[model samples]
Target: MTVAPHPALSANLATPTQAPAQRDDAPIELSTLRLPTPPVPPDTCVIDVAQLFLDANYAGLLSLPIVAADGAPVGMISRYELMRVFLQPYGRELFGRRPISVLMNHAPLVLSVETSIGDAARAIAQHIRSPITDDFVLVENGRYVGTALVLDVLRAVEGRLADRSTELERAYVRLKSSQAQLVQSEKMASLGQMVAGLVHEINTPLGYVRNNVEMTRGVLADASQLIVAQQAALDALLGGDVVADAQARLDEVETLRLRVDPAALDDTAALLDDTLHGVGQIGDLVINLKDFSRLDQAGAQKADLNHLVASALKIANHILRKRGIEVVHQPGELPPVECAPAQINQVLLNLLTNAAQAIEHERGRIVVATRAVEGRAMVLIQDNGKGIAAENQARIFDPFFTTKPVGEGTGMGLAISRQIIEQHGGAIRMTSSVGQGTRFVVVLPLRAVVREAA
Candidate 1:
């Protein structure tokens, strides 16, 4: 996910340097250099630096930079504050060619390094907004500390998530030993839960096996002897000359059948059979669960792409239930692909979720199709949603950027997805237009079987 392009700021991103300063009691005027600067493009505002100020805003450098005591900047200011001035005509003219001293908003909202991000976000919402023209500034004691640009806020939130992907990528490298330990830990936890369920699952079958054995022993010991007696009588009748003997033998066999109690035997067999069938179902469930959560699949392996997709679809079936999103798969019994199955699953999840969210009014449809291309396995996920705008297509993978409303997403999904796919020796490409829809194509190497043959 990428952060939306800010209206006030240019495409360039700037990283401010931290410097030392002496404390001053009287208000110190901020200059243009201390304002929000992008590291991407380093150029002074050529027209009038005043244009950098939000529309009609009184604030100079409309960006409030966090400064060390010596008046060196540690952080920049807020655009929302600059916007307040844009509403007035004088604020617009006042911004023109004016010295930052006369125009800069003196009181910058500041925060400490230890401050929780939640508190920082709240501070920005409450005190630092425009009219007040302050934002949560990073402060260490009485000195300026670090800065959290609005563009970088979400990126900062996922502080721990950085290593998560790095671990997955260079997983076999020497440095990945710690990452392997983490994956091992994950495996152990998953195995523990699986073991518990399996024990409960096996217990039912064991209990019935005990009951079945007891019933089978009783039937063979008691009822079987009676059947033998009836057979003996029938043999004697057949050997005799008298019709009365044959009638008596037939009656004897009927007597044994009547004494056996057929209902009990039927009940025992049914219970044992049902228990066996249930055990089979439980084993199947365990296998699917294990397959879904396996972490070692980080290494690329030759496997069935269609089978993997189908399994992942089954696992994610619950997510699609309430969204009115239908997933259609045009999968053939495809050749194996050299890929990391888990990463592929993660990519599919992101695409599927995005497809579901893209729908506006009525139903939405996503088609996942597979085919062969060159020496690769070609997978396409197509969605009928609001679609991507031309302006935003290139920036879609920038971290912390999101098109969705505030609080709905952190915007790391696609960026991470692309990285993961690329690490597995694959490429992900997308195509979309405003009114139409979006299609994501994932291309991976064909199975080694096919490659070797070539």
Candidate 2:
């Protein structure tokens, strides 16, 4: 195949960038950047150079290659030097009859097709004996294939650099945006888990509060009737003899006691205490949720794994209680972990909620345990629910892979959980057998190095 010179070659050859033509194996090869080689037969005359130039259709080209009979580059000839020689007195007559090889550069700049532009430019710059305008021969497998100009290589490098800069800028913008979205996604998922248990948790205490208030109202009414009875007795005493009405008043008081029910009044203090305790329980859930969904605390910090589990449990209690699932916490003494507390809380909550949702029947039991092992903190959450099938277990961590009915799950819980845990220098894995149970083990380092952005 005959390769032609670029149409803009003439314009660029005059003011080429000061780049060398040293050969190198880089990503961008000279083969893709080289122009067609301007060649002449070994026997071609110096006077025939004009016809050679016209044949190649590169009038502005300053250098041309002299090829041997076998098409190997023998040397190069420069238009500037050629014109100088011909301008001498009888110079054309003296040399025009001889082959161009007599005056051609025998050791011109040469580069391989595989040469990288940087190395090529460096090589060209190092060849101080040769002019910058000299076109370097591009050879492949020891045969002349094409030629390259420094200007073309520099232009290619500049364009490539510009494209790379744009690409990096786009990637950076996407990273920042994704980080923001990830934080919001975690918050929403945490909120969703908390909301699942919210109705039952709030209703339980609210029901008790209503019952206690009703009972207290009845107690107040009974007390009011007793006060009226005592007042009537006082009126009788003030208007008549005290001793006479004392016995009657005492009888009325006895009747009033019967109506008031002394046992009920005795229980008032305990009933109020129970109501107060119920309200406090509801309040605790709210606070736990608030701490669990700490979206603003995105930075890493020292945290206790046990406390994170406890907070997650509190947030997921409504789900556990609703399903009659018993949670047994067996926490071992552990050191604090350096991580993002809120994200860790989010991970724990996801595991607990998933355990609750996996239960197909009542009496489901979830066991959450934490321990320190080999300078690492491990959290084990096991559930005696309908365990995952072997085929489906592997895909549970994949995004949008959920067994829940439509709209009941976004399938992002485990996926996001894994991301958060891994970002904290931790790992989460699960083991399950269908109809038996499922166990999730999360291992985290006590002190974690901050993760770099992808």
Candidate 3:
């Protein structure tokens, strides 16, 4: 039996709208891969369908959609099916005049034009079989729109994946850049606070040194007057001047000598010693500032953790003193730990600062102790302050997590400290009881280890 060809099928042979440019933020739809191949009516003969496949116009297509009278897709007829039929002995004569539906796939993979490329690929995966016979059909509102090749859908999906991978790589790069910036900003903020304290630390010594110099200047002036008077008396005596004149010069010398207290000389010497000590104190502070400001330097070295702790403590002394916090340093003999000194200094300072801030009352005490345990360097910082809450302890190291009031903290100190420690092949842990106190322990390997940037 034969069937009349549908006129609507011929009208759809015109090219469809071109696909839009792909975007990373947008999901690609199946319509972008659609090919407007004309469909065949269900009653069309096998011979006529075979002739259509042979035409160069439809050579690239694997199958043609078989639509019902109302434009609904019923099945698909593939080139492989026709080739099989014609290749068989006496096959063309037996089935050539029959309806193509007799050999068409009654159930094809049908998807809407609005389906995402990923979803379309998944559907094809589930429904596809070995030896890949037919192309999937694209429809709109339950009616046939056009047919698309399985190979085209596969290519589109692959392209989308490649695009997604590229986008992810870019995003990762941006995230790393942002992280670096944040680390540097925190360093600057810490430095600013440290500088304010250091200024006071330096001024205390500078004030005494200035006063000592002034006192010494007064002593030197009196001594010079005595020297001049004694010289004059010697000149009068040696030049055979009158006894009265010589006696007058000698009397002037005696008077000046009496005015210069003998103890003033001794006191001047002591003042000089104190001045030297004050200068040395200033020098040591400058050195600590230099070490603390080495934030831009990268690379690790074997360093005495005790020295780093001391330096951090010195810088933070002003803060602790202002709050009347007592700091106890108990450093034990241990092997040197290889690490980035500047970064470790930053971590120590951050911890000390946090400890100082945690205390809301006078009589705050912070104990910093170091020891070697099992070939690893350990630093324990315990603070007697209002400690972290039980629920908030777990997320203390999470980025941007803070219990402090807004504008008083950046919430990155603990997070960055943890990152720095972990990158150095170390671990940091915390234990606290709400009103009792909090203790942070940092354990580090005593040998150098390759570290990756976070």
Candidate 4:
């Protein structure tokens, strides 16, 4: 009965299961490390230059001490240095003012990646003039390889330890990065769950198309009867069947003694075809929506604006039909946008749906136009509903600021709309009148600027 368990397996069974590690209170080395790269070719943006100026002015990246080119020492870029190059009295005009490259300090100080964080911080303290030092780009061999910021190094080395602690912590971060990926994988799973529900919600209108086909058949039958009776009475009076020239003058159906002739049953067939066609359009919208919400969990890419618009229309059809509204799309088309299609579609969906529902009473009209303007594609969704009140216009885009009844609105539509557009480096604007209607316009550049840190 005394069979011995393997040491490793026995220990595994004997000890309680270990809890998974969380990032809180963890060392900098344990913190997520983005093995830094030189902010150069491929990922760098000219905008980064402007971002440097703006971020430097705001985020205080300007004064963070720079390590020497040889990883020997550190120094800070002063306000005077920044202003001399940045042209600061008009900092607000920087984006339209000039290229950012002219402002960047070349041959700035650098540091070795293996340099202990404790020494790096001390080096920064010894060289820093004012405010604080933030970065220490680590170089290896002869070129810049990765960044080892003051903050990152401080986190890497905390408590009574030596180089071993830093190595352990850095190793932990390297391992932890893989773990963080698993966390992202989990979020993707949640998004998949959202899409499943959306698919079900979309099938609703498709179900109604089948019912509408039947209703159209009935209405066509009634319409045919009215048409046939009129024609038959006219034919008899002209043909002199039970009605001579003198009797043709008879006033009404009863007085004329008219006989009924069956109407062409085929008219009902044509009417049914037309009605069914109208109803099937709603189904196409559902397909487009499914396309927009597709589970492409990766990053941004080119997207079909037309297809995206169609899906949003499908999702909003619930409100559009009730208002007896018609949507008109212009003929102009576009190339795919090099941005996040799903997110952009969400914004467009919100705008189009909002426009369709803005009208509380009577039939309305919605117009959508898309085309290139000023090196960017512009999309406009306009609704002829009761225009927005001047008082509420400013606050309309604020999150959770809806005027809808409880349970019917989340007030997040416009706010979410704004965020989605901005994420794509775009702008959205709205125009409205008290008695007329509301209109939303979105503008996004054709090309995207890839951002990198220098």
Query: Using Cα atoms with residue i matched to residue i, what is each candidate's TM-score against the true structure?
Result: 0.40, 0.69, 0.93, 0.42
Candidate lDDT (C-alpha), each? 0.58, 0.79, 0.90, 0.56
Displacement of residue 25 (Cα, Å) in model 3 is: 3.1
Model 1 agreement with the true structure over 270-376: per-residue lDDT tens digits: 86686677667557656666676776776668888887777656555544544667889999646778777766766676676676677674677788898887878
The sequence of per-residue lDDT tens digits that candidate 2 reaches over residues 26-61 is 356677776665466656788887456555456656
CA shift at 387, candidate 3, in angstroms? Answer: 1.7
lDDT of 4 by residue, 1-454 (tens): 1222223223323433232353444433311322332232212223443344354222533332333334322333334555554475655465334433344344454655445445566776775445443354445553444344455545545442665687789999887686445434433433343355455555564565566666565665555554555566677677767655335434444432332223434445665666566556645655665666664722577767766676666666656665688888773577777766766666776677677658776768999888877778888898888888999999998866988776545676677667657766778899999878888999887774412100
Clashing pairs in 3: none
RMSD of each: 21.4, 8.8, 2.4, 23.5
Model 2, residue pairs in steric clash: 20-120, 20-121, 20-124, 21-120, 21-124, 22-120
- In candidate 1, residue 258 scores what lDDT? 79
Candidate 2 — what's its lDDT? Answer: 0.79
TM-score of 1: 0.40
- Model 4 residue runs over 4 Å out of place are 1-286, 449-454
User: Higher TM-score: candidate 1 or 2?
Assistant: 2
lDDT for 358 (candidate 3): 96
Q: lDDT for model 1, please.
A: 0.58
Error of 4 at 16 (Å): 43
Tell me the TM-score of model 4: 0.42
Worst 10 residues of 2 by lDDT: 1-10
